[model samples]
Target: MARYIDAEKLKCSIDSETDSIFDWDMTIEELYYNLCKLIDDEPTADVQPVKRGTWENTNTPNQLRCSNCEIIHFIAQYPHGEINYCPNCGARMDGVLSE
Candidate 1:
C-alpha cells in the first residue's frame, strides 16, 4: 500500500513554518517548486493486481476501471503484470477504481 499526503495540507504546513520562521516572505513560485519537489520525491506504491474470478460465467472482482475511458475491463483478458496501459484507450492504468 502507498501513503499519500494532500498537497493542500502540505502547503499549509509549509506556510505555518515559513510564517513563524521567515515572516511569511516565501514567494508563490518557491512554494510551488517545493511542493513539486516533495511530490516527486514521494515513493510510488508497488502495483498490486486487483483480485479476479468468475461468477456464473461472468467476470468477478471487476478488475480495475480505466479513469480516462470509463471502461470496465475483465481481468481474464489481460495477463498478470502486463496491464500497465489500457487496451481500449491507451491510457495509463492508475489503478484507481471507478465510482
Candidate 2:
C-alpha cells in the first residue's frame, strides 16, 4: 500500500546525507536515487490510513448513509453491500468485514 511521508523530514535526511556521502565520483543522479531508497526504507506518519465506514439505511428508499461521516448517498437499490468506499469521505465502507 502507498502512504505519505513527512516531506520536511525527508528533506532533512537528504541534506544531512549530501555532505557526508558525496564524493568526487558520485553523480547528483546517484545521490538522488540513494536518497529515494533511504526515504523508502524509513517510515513516517504523514497521514493516517483510510478511514473506515459502514452503510446505514436511510428513510428514503435506495439511499444509504455513511456511518462514519453521516454523508448520504443515493443508489439504484437497497442492500448496498457492493459499495466499498464513501464518495464524500473516501472511507472504506466495510464495518462488518473489518471488525
Candidate 3:
C-alpha cells in the first residue's frame, strides 16, 4: 500500500523549526521532500488522498491524476473511498483533477 503524508502538516512542521533563510528559495514540494528526509518520514503528497470507497463502483470516472508525479490512475481498479493513495508514487489521490 502507498503511504501519504499531509502536505499542510509537513509544511507547518517545517515552518515552526526553520528560519526564513531557506524559505524564499524552496517550493512546497521541495520543502516537503527535504523535511521528510530530515525526519525520516514518508514524503508529502502533492494533494490529499481521495476518500476511498466513496465513488460508485460501477462506471467510476477514470481521469484522476497526481499533480506532483503527473501519473494517471485507473479509477475502476479502486473501490470507491478506498483509493486514498496513488499506486504510482504513493501520493494522495484526493483533489485529482479531471483531464
Best by TM-score: 2
Report the lDDT of model 1 for residue 34: 67
Candidate 3 C-alpha lDDT tens digits along 4-74: 67767766766776763247788988777776575555365666654332112223356555555656567
Angstrom error at residue 69, model 3: 0.9
Q: Once model 1 is optimally superposed onto the true structure by TM-score, how far is the C-alpha of residue 84 displaced, in angstroms?
A: 0.4
Off by over 4 Å in 1: 1-60, 94-99
Q: What tens digits encode model 1's per-residue C-alpha lDDT throughout 15-66?
A: 7555443435788777777667666654554455443321111245746566
Error of 3 at 81 (Å): 2.6
Candidate 2: Cα lDDT at 99: 18
CA deviation > 4 Å runs, candidate 2: 1-45, 77-82, 96-99
lDDT against true structure, model 3:
0.58
Per-model C-alpha lDDT, please? Answer: 0.57, 0.76, 0.58
- Regarding lDDT, does 1 or 2 come out ahead? 2
TM per candidate:
0.32, 0.46, 0.32
Model 2 RMSD vs true structure: 8.1
Q: Pick by lDDT: which candidate is best?
A: 2
Worst ten in a row by lDDT for model 3: 51-60
